[model samples]
Target: MNDKMNLYYLKQLLNKKHVMLVYAIVKMSVYICFVLFVFFSLFSIDFRDMQLSQSLIFATEEINNSSSLLPGVSLGYKIYDTCSSTTMGVRVAMALINGNENSALNEQCTKPAQVLAIIGETQSSVSMTIAKTLAEMVKHFGWTWVGALRRDDDYGNSGMAAFTEAAEQLGICLEYSMSYFRTYSQEKVLRIIQQIKSSTSRVIVAFVTHLDFEILLDVFYEHNITGYQWVGTESWISDSTVARLDKHKILQGAIGLAIPNTTVTGLKEFILDINPLKSTGSTIFTEFWEALFKCKYTVQNDSEDTTVCTGKEKLSETDNEYTDMTLMPFFCNVYKGVYAVAHTLHDLLGCNFGTDVSVNSFRCYGEEVYFDKNGDPVAKYEIINLQTVEDHHEFVMVGIYDSSFPAHNRLSVKMASVPVSVCSESCPPGTRKAVQKGKPICCFDCIPCAEGEISNMTDSIKCEQCYQDFWSNPHRNECVKKEIEFLSYDETMGILLTAVSITGTFITIIIAIIFFRYKNTPIVKANNSELSFLLLFSLALCFLCSLTFIGRPSEWSCVLRHTVFGITFVLCISCVLGKTIVVLMAFRATLPGSNVMKWFGPPQQRLSVLAFTFIQVFICVLWLTTSPPFPFKNLNYYKEKIILECQLGSAVGFWAVLGYIGLLALLCFVLAFLARKLPDKFNEAKFITFSMLIFCAVWITFIPAYVSSPGKFTVAVEIFAILASSFGLLSCIFLPKFYIIIMKPEKNTKKQLMSKVPVK
Candidate 1:
């Protein structure tokens, strides 16, 4: 044959070593046999599909076993692989046509078994020696490689141009584009089929009217051009006449953007009519068996299990798309959601479904959605249908859909099953639509929403943003509130801080009691008993104030946390300042002609302590009046949780309050340092000086930590400083005297106060 010589020359010219065509054959030259040339994946041995091959053989066996269909005919079939290529399929087809098993007229096209009909190369794209296109609708269904067919008129050309431009943007490539005119010859039509049979595209974008589409449909039917996905413009997509005219089922599952009012009357019956034993309209019955039964006839290449489908599985026991009519809504939306057009009935009773639908609306035209307590709409839908009532076509209510009901109970319709017409499946909840690159918005990849974001509805373009304290749950369906955090007494750190503060308070109280028990003693009297008692009281207040920072922050707690801290610390420091001044006065009174103790007595000491504490009180009040510390959530500190902490509003006011306490502490340190060496075993100045040193050190360290610490730690740091300073003052000033008074009773006498010697 000339075809064999051309391939030989082409191979010689290209210098190719790989086999372009390969097949197996049996000599059945006597009786007419069926040549079943099935398509198989050439590359990747693990992925080669043998289902179509099995189906052809199974059908042949089933037909031979059957007596009613072909009573006298004992049909024979020769199965072969076509390598899923048009050129190979053609060579194989030629070889089958020659009816030679070994060497034929074209040796390159050899391997022919005696056959009557050329069943297929399996896929319609390859069956025509091949076949087959959306830019959005095309890309939605992942038809990247496609062909374009159009009418010669302006309508077809303009529409196709738009589709082409969009397809190009969406990364869709057209292998062959052609037009169908009213004056085209039969030969021209055959050539177009020849082109389609040769092209590798499995999808076709037909931009022609319903009327014009008939011209090409006839040719398509003659060539058995079904299987390739068809996408049409609105001008033809909704035409029921064209859908009915498709006898070869060429446009069975066609989907595109348009309001399709067309419904196939015998669709259920037509779908159920496809049975391998009854109908020979299709050759790939094995694939259909696997799809309908949800089982594979053969184990996969990667799998070693011998388990395979029985092939005797009954369709009566299966509930698949073919049998289940209650599965979904037939008309699926790819671009936009189905907007509820609440068309009213004659009497305005209630909402209508389709044709004579009755709907009730506040304004009859307002498209407002009502929301529930959770801020989500509880949608109620009415199914509508067109009906002829009193010789007038009207919209009739058919069924209803209440979103508030449970999943299986939401819809109540009279119809047996719903038809789902879609370019691509819907993106379910928890996922957001990611538009395919170079494609339209409708053709998108369903990517899961990021953590902390959620998508409640199907086909959501963007995820919803959570509130300030809320976050997305694991499923990403709803926003749940984040965990609240603070330095509460319940936690480990909070319990420790609280215990220390309480222990420090009790210790200060016991020290006060000890001082009171020994009030008549020389050591207690010499250390200015009145100021000592007040100092102990202030230390106790300091310890207790820290407990305020241990619990949840609120308006009251926030105000108290800072103000109480400022006032109590200032009071404690002032008492030390008073004692320091008293020591200097006592030493000066021992000088010649000096009556300094008279002017600065216990009464004056009390006034100075009151005056020092009063300054802190005034600062705290001003801070509160202008800008008070209040409860605030620190979100940036941790992304997973909210930090329930107090905001020290107006840094100037907080610093001023703290600075005043530091000024008092610093003054006490200087004066105490001056009198530290001034006489006596019971010299209180030395003890006062050490206490001031600890107080100043603790407070000075607190400034940086307070500013640097995050969330609950900042509050913890402040409490630590308060407790540390209080303990410092209590131990340094009171512990020594208590040792003398209780442990060394001999030193608790007047001799100690007048000795003018160190304790050693």
Candidate 2:
């Protein structure tokens, strides 16, 4: 029973065999279409993504910041005494120099010097002298410790030895030691200047008694040697005469020294506090310290009002702001110096100090210096170009100087971060940055190859030179290659067709002789009229150079190549068409005047071919000169190279090329479809039609590709397209036909077809 049922199923399948085959073919075509769609879509998406990422990443990495951080705790202090009496000069002098020396030395040393605290001139010349000496010593030694002081000595060295001896008694070896001289005569001051100028050590310690600082200032300004840093002691301060000397320009770069109180705000408050009592007739400590340090007004208090002040005073006092001899606040540069060091240390060690404002003092357990023993900071110093807002005064401060500024209301500080190095040369060509600010030779970036150039080794340290026909810039970062140009269809394939025509004519002549010699034979007498016309037509079109390449031609020849190429292509197609028609008609000629035979009869068929060729020629000539065909004037950017190309006029022109090819493809497709029903003997039409379809497809797609290609390669692209078209025609259409007919004549006809005798 199973055998009978299987036989019945086989019979039914056999009946629908044609339908099954069609269904299978349709399904396979659908699968192919889907696969092509997905493949192209993915390719396009990836290409777009690659292009976008290139621009964004390149733009973002060029400029970056590297600023350091501020320290957490209040590291140091500045003290200023503003009393305009005997000590004012000393106070002002000390304010400029004291902590500044240590700051400068810290900059040069291989380590940062962090001075945590500072106490200043007891608002006096005597105190300023001591402060100045201490600052010089710190500078000389490159000490990094925080320093504090009791006061200065316009009270003279009367107090220095006592203070030192007292500190010594307490087992505190003075960290710093210094000296000074005091004089008053102009001759003495000039002699002192001369003496210092002549001395081997070249040191100036101004501690003159009763001599104004202006005389010394005038002498120094007149002498102005480059490297002198004039540091003064107590007696140098309280003199009123120096204030009259123009400090802005004369004492501009001079360095002074003084002890500064811990807090600027505190000192300001103290000034304010003293301001209220100035009119009260109340004796304050400010008044006492001023007189004592300035060498004026000895105290007679015994015990009266002793809570506010203690000490002897100077008898000389002046009211002139410029000439006041009162011991005033020594405005300390140490305020910024100390703070700067603390902040720098914190940054170097990556430490946070603390956040409280009132907490007056700070210390580090094992303060790590960001330097070696050379007193040079390990970190780089940023050279600042600072200008004062009030006076437009300008100066440079290396490293951090947020708080420790000299007098004249100028402090050197800015928000910009210190750069590690000012400016280094951009990396040499051929290498790219492996990482930013990284040392070269290690972590270096690679130079990419330029266009029209390629490197075999992708890891090449330097880009290789481009091959012949190519060149790149100095860095070899880009490349350009010599372009290939086809010029036009006439230049290349036209010559090729001419050669093919000569060869084909020779073959045709040989074949004709052979046919005549064997005239009695039926196969020989059977004329291949289609091949004859094709050979003749192709030969005429190919040899007619009158119209093709000759630049200056009569209107006839001008009209000639256009018609010739059109005729040649048409004849080429019609030859194949005629051959197919001939074969079909020969088999079906028994039926009278068949459509193939009638439509393609010798004279009518030739005329038809001529008509079609002329129509194409007319259309081509008209289109070639119109805006759609010849839009752009060829521009010559290079001296040697010239290009001839058809530019699309507009969107309409762009679509015109596409539309023309589409029509040709449709015609070839229709012919191939109709010819498919024909018997195998006439199947040559199928091959010819398929070849035309391939040619049309290549050019139709090529139009867009050529148009969109960059100018550098657009001409090359057109050349490639022409080459591909010619090569395809020669190989696919002509090569196979010649292979069988000329190379192997035995396969030209079947034995049965040849043996069948014609009935006369």
Candidate 3:
């Protein structure tokens, strides 16, 4: 009965409003503490260097202090050290994923753990083992012609194998793949360095941890190996230990992928305020202090050789090596990871600040950290150039690789800042690339294009031929229109030859007039006056025919020039032949048995001249009707010029015409030689012999000169031959006759002519 009454009184007390309000406030306070204790775990390297640890801690603090991220819900974090080991990193990652470091394989988390997100494993090999999505990020960077340098271990071997397969699918050529180790012997390290130095690849993609890279770099420094464009993994790119090395000069102009860095307000001040005395519970702070100040804590002991820390050193004034906010890419990754968990939790709880919230809605420090469909943060990377500034090496953000940008513009690097990693320089215009045997495409020999071919761009594969009417310039870079060339009256050679030809023609005319005026004289009659007049007329025609070759070639000039020359010269030789025959007959007639003089009279001489001239005319007519010469623009002989000259349509016809003239001259010369000893006053046979000799000499030389001369000079040579031969005939044969007819009129009488000649 007593216990029943006590229970009734307790129920009455619980029904009071003030007692219920106090109970509800205490329940709300416990729930708030539970939310604030839920932590995001971060796995980073902190054994040899504490930059990554400091970065993760600073990032977590920044997100926890932000009120806009997760209102009324405070955030907490748990940090784990991987010691830059893949084994340790995997254990850490699995512990975070499984919610228990020692849980059985079958044991699953019945409730969500306080840890929400795991930041990183830092090293690429470790990241590959834990984060399988990192291969996509590497693919996004689009590196081709890359060299793969990895650690000689399971993490590196597996990661590089997967990376190489993915790279092959993306059409990336692996120039060389090599392995390294921190415990490598000096000989082995030398061999690796030699391989790197001899490799044609200039870009080396290193998939090694910071400690392994440092070891490899020591060997590289000993050998003075540099100028390699190192494409680093996240394992060492953001590590200040490598960046602050004394021999960092070897890494100048390196470019690599890095997580984007953002300023976390008040983070620098918080790090600078850390003190050993104030944070005695933090062993990391004490270690960092000793490293920064190069001093250690000493107790009051018997030994007096120890340096003691006063714990009064200012961290801000000292070199805050690991606390540098600017060089902290891993810090930003951890910072974003924490905020991502906070925002996701806020949406999960349906805590609306101003609008309806979704799991994807999240912003921290004014920057959104959204996860992709794969439940991974949207990958964003900064392309950084490791450059030297004020005698120290640091990474400068050169470009951004964002999926939001177009593919063509996505990977834009500052070309001036980026060094070229090619095997050879580019081939300039006017040349083509001649690829070397068993060598890369970039390693080729630049060769000039052959004559008449052109390459108008750099690294041209083949040269293109110019048009038939065009020719390549000296540089072989472009085709230029050929110059049209011919023997024109305006040019010097044409003008000179024309003047000479006209002068020869005028001289022949003047000689003809003198012979006509003294037609009744004995000297003119002694040398066959009709033949003399015909020969002089034919010589004038020969000289005038040379004028046809002086101007630009035309159809009429091409046909008439050679035909008229052949016929006129034949006529001249015929006249000499007729005169030689008459002289021989006259001498024979003066002998005891000589009817030759009567048989070969003026009529026979005329018939002889007409017959020879008619035969040449027939040949000329047949040549014109069958295979006529025509004006031709020849482009093949000279590259920069067009030879505007006549083409001999039939070579046989051209040679036949010249051969016939030569036959007539030879016959005349032979006849003149047989009658040269005759006692005639003038000895016309001697003059005919000399004239035919000069004509034949000129024609024989003209053939070779015409054949060998180029362009306009060929026409000039032909014209020169005509004028020379014609002048030879006129001066040799007619000049002596004119002198006797004008100055020695007594010797020109018929009685003197008959007395000078002796009968055989």
- All candidates: TM-score: 0.50, 0.32, 0.68
lDDT by residue (108-219, candidate 2, tens digit) is 3233222222333332324432433333332332221211222224344544554444433332233223333333455655654555555333223333332444444556
Candidate 1 vs candidate 2, TM-score winner = 1
Q: What CA root-mean-square deviation does each model show from the true structure?
A: 22.8, 34.7, 11.4
Report how far off residue 297 is in candidate 3 (Å).
15
Q: Relative to the true structure, how large is the alpha-carbon lDDT of every model?
A: 0.64, 0.38, 0.69
Q: Which candidate has the highest TM-score of all?
A: 3
Q: Write one digit per residue (lDDT tens) for candidate 1, span 318-431.
A: 754345432112221100011111111112223222323222222201334344554333445444332334543333445555666886676555533334323345788899
What is the Cα-based TM-score of model 2? 0.32
Residue-wise lDDT of candidate 3 within 51-158, one digit each (tens)?
Answer: 444445565555556676445444455555443345545654565555563441234544333244455544542345322223343344443456778877655677
Q: Which model, 2 or 3, shows the larger TM-score? A: 3
**Candidate 3 Cα lDDT to native:** 0.69
TM-score of 3: 0.68
Which candidate has the top score in lDDT? 3
Poorly placed runs, candidate 2 (over 4 Å): 1-588, 592-599, 628-645, 650-665, 680-683, 696-709, 712-721, 747-760
